[model samples]
Target: MTTGHPFMQAHPHQPLSIAAKILSPQMIQTIRKLPEFHLQAWKILDRWAFNSPEMLAQLEAQGEIVLMSRLLDQQAVEHQALMDSTHQLQNGMTEHEILEMCEIHTEL
Candidate 1:
């Protein structure tokens, strides 16, 4: 689910937002078109962020800025609220939730 956008900000274990969850390859394609923005996110990636450089390159090389902008928009959307949104699952997909869910429920 990377476009090599140089953002390197995607958490390996975390679920990407809906845009990514639904359109991964397409997202990467969007980033390939916007190198500058990708680089910006890249600066923030690490153990505390999206630290994978190889994944970043995949996003950038694909020109998936729509996905890049979508990623930024995901951040911006949260910035507008400044509240906690960790428990809410996107589109009711328990497996798609970023935080780990109850394994018992998922296994059922």
Candidate 2:
């Protein structure tokens, strides 16, 4: 992916304006020159990318990549939270409970 790609964001909670920085000149041109022929057709350019299979595939692939990245990111956050909670509790769960939580986390 190119620089400034949404998936390349360094932080999960970065502002949307940062993601919007991906609109390069070439992307703008590509958007302007999309091949829509029917004047009477009620399709909006914003929705055209979803209607094109190739474009949709690209978007879906990127979407999947983003989703997987976020999923892993969330697990890291949850694990850190659990560790922090354990530290604060001064007494942790039994070995069986830890093993069960590990199993459930991996299944997710």
What is the TM-score of each predicted model, taking all chains together? Answer: 0.28, 0.24
Residue 23, model 1: Cα distance from true site in angstroms = 21
Residues 40-102, model 1: lDDT tens digits: 232222211334445544544566554355456544433323223333433343222322232
Q: Lowest summed lDDT over 10 consecutive residues: which window, candidate 1?
A: 99-108
Error of 1 at 31 (Å): 12
lDDT of 2 by residue, 1-107 (tens): 12322222243432322212332344334333444322111111122232343543344347544533433454454455456457433564532244245553322
Runs of candidate 2 exceeding 4 Å displacement: 1-62, 87-108
Q: TM-score: which candidate is best?
A: 1
Q: Which ten residues in a row have the lowest lDDT in candidate 2?
A: 37-46
